[model samples]
Target: MPSEWDTHTSVTATGDGLFGAELDPGWVVGGGVNGGYLLGILGRAVAESVPAKPHPLSVSAYYLSASTPGPAQVSTRVLREGGSVATVAAELGQEGVTRITALATYGDLRAMHGDVATTAEEPALPPIEECVPGTMAPEEVRRIAPLMERFDIRFDPACVGWAMGAPSGNGLIQGWFRMADGHDVDPVGLLMVCDALPPVTFDLGLPGWAPTLELTVHVRAVPTPGWLKVSHRTRNVAGGMFEEDCEVWDSAGRLVAQSRQLAMQPRR
Candidate 1:
């Protein structure tokens, strides 16, 4: 049996470079569908269009409007297919309105082998058991954000203060995460998990829907099966917008994915 993530992110090719998909309401957060989940839909479309490229090396997406649970259309166009990679343009449309536009570079992870050097270290986190429940949103939060239940997220207790009306006044949030349904993480899933956490604004005492404007993800390595250590940090917030950077490290201590996103500041 396929995992829920696969079941929901699944897509069917229509014709003329178009694909049809369904947005699962369970993945809805705040007022619309989770951005990461939406990316999964788009990513799947591009992946299938270029079957030789089984993994996404990099993906950049611009969210034009909020997406809701319903039928969605994905239109894809292959831009370039080369010896090592393939580039594809894809978009998600709903209710006749285009909600997202993306460009993705796909390649085979198994075929990737090159020099890699990194000075960045994984975010410090206590054992998962010592962390707080990262899946349960408060009643007020639950009313608007039900997507948390789809994951097994154990947050570092220090950065989770906003859940109790108190924030750490910092821009860092760290946690361990995996699909609650036990779906193993993959390159496509990396696109989703990289943006799975609560907005960075929540750690700064700003509680509201922080809609993403743009998100770019680079998949590093195929993650070894285990809980993923995820961290999100923002050092800049201005002009009613903020930029957050995220890192996802596998249990083996390998950097599996890196992402940066620009989003609106929360307004209640």
Candidate 2:
């Protein structure tokens, strides 16, 4: 329950190449770098280095080894910048060994012809204000509440309630969120938060330990939603690995992003 940042080494910026950060305690089952956020971090690093206004729309990261939260580096290389899309390749390494390789694409929206569809009618979930705030585990509450405070989260107790033994059904969850500080919540920032949540969903029914191994996200737009709704459901779990898929929607129920993850299950 220590600080997420405190548990890890400081992030360093290498002026010559890529930025690097390290995680402390190396790697644990459910405590590794959230995969979704890793993709976002790599994607942001790539898009920010470019002169174009387009942001990364898709990110794919392969886990080469256990990403320890101690000291790691992210190196980015621009692969191609065409008339429409820019492709980037990134590698994260620790102690001279590659840990993750990521490829990302950035593009600007210029009005394309495509069929726009909507998600089916979903029942209105509880409001964040009405949902109970963290109070049970003081250490965990101390750690995550500040982080949540940074983002405007309209949480559904029905989703997180199970962690407190409230009988949260299966691996189904819904919630709304946006950056609370009013910073430009780009796709990468959005992805970071997305990858951080599925572990909770996957651990809903388990009596003990869980950790995410890898996460991949496909983003469609910059996502300027006043409220971003997330619907997460577990697809399958086998051979000590689990997968959870989620769809992200705007306040008006417009689909904006999609994500999937694979994690290792470790029992206490």
Candidate 3:
């Protein structure tokens, strides 16, 4: 079975600097299309436009408006192209209304190297089998957000007490994540996985929709083939807004991707 992401990210070149893709209904969250998925589509256009630099180094997406399931068009404009790196600006639209605008820098990951230092430690997470499935009953999910069914996610038991009516009071969620269809993680897939987890504010007993206003992801390295260990946390929530920081570590213990997003708090 093809992964939902594979199907959705597949785009056809329609014309010069223009591409078309059909957004899958399964990629919806709270009646709006997933921001990361939209970014993946935009990244595809950027990558194809600049074939010399295929890997996304950093992508910054700003959600202009909400989008629904349908055929969307991506228009790309190459901003800069160097021997080692390329930058592109792209937009995603449906029915002639633009929904997302993004600026992305792409390059060959193999040609990049630098002294890497990190004070951040990977969060401890139990084995996938030992963690709690980050999903509701199938029937409930089917009616609410069928998109979630496309991912295999297992959340840290300690941070999931909110689901059991015991709020942890800390905005942190750690988990193991992978495609339900078992697709290997690629650079494009890494973009989607970075935002796959439920909002960190969920553990703080906030529920509903936490719509992302802006999201920026940095692809650190190519991911090894295996489940990704993910950690998402929010340090502050004020004035109906919050910021989430996420880290994606491949099974080989490599930091593959890191992201931060500004999103609205759940409205009750």
Choose the strongest candidate by TM-score.
1
User: How much is 131 displaced in model 3, in angstroms?
Assistant: 0.4
TM-score of each: 0.97, 0.75, 0.95
Candidate 3 lDDT by residue in tens digits, 1-268: 7766767798899999999999888888877977888888888888899998989999999888999998999999999998899999999999899998899999988778997777778779987788998565356545667777888889889988877778798899888888888888788778888788778888889877898999999998888999999999999899989999999998888888999999999986
Model 1, span 122-230: residue lDDT tens: 8899998999986566777766777887899999999899988899989988999999987788899999998999998989999888989999999989999989999
Ranking by lDDT: 1, 3, 2
Q: For each candidate in the order shown, give its overall lDDT on alpha carbons.
A: 0.92, 0.61, 0.87
lDDT of 2 at 250: 66
User: After superposing candidate 2, which stretches have Cα over 4 Å from the reference?
Assistant: 1-17, 20-31, 65-72, 110-113, 120-123, 134-152, 180-184, 198-203, 207-209
Model 2, 1-268: lDDT tens digits are 4333222323456864478665433223343544544455456557655648356577777777656456667788888887777888888777888877877777764433468765555436676577544333357543533334444555577777665666475777666666554444555565665654435543366644355566677776556646677777776767887777777766656666787878676463
What is the RMSD of candidate 3? 1.5
Assess candidate 1 and give its TM-score to the true structure. Answer: 0.97
List clashing residue pairs in candidate 1: none
Between candidates 2 and 3, which one is better according to lDDT?
3
lDDT comparing candidate 3 with the true structure: 0.87
TM-score order of candidates, top first: 1, 3, 2
CA shift at 246, candidate 3, in angstroms?
Answer: 0.8
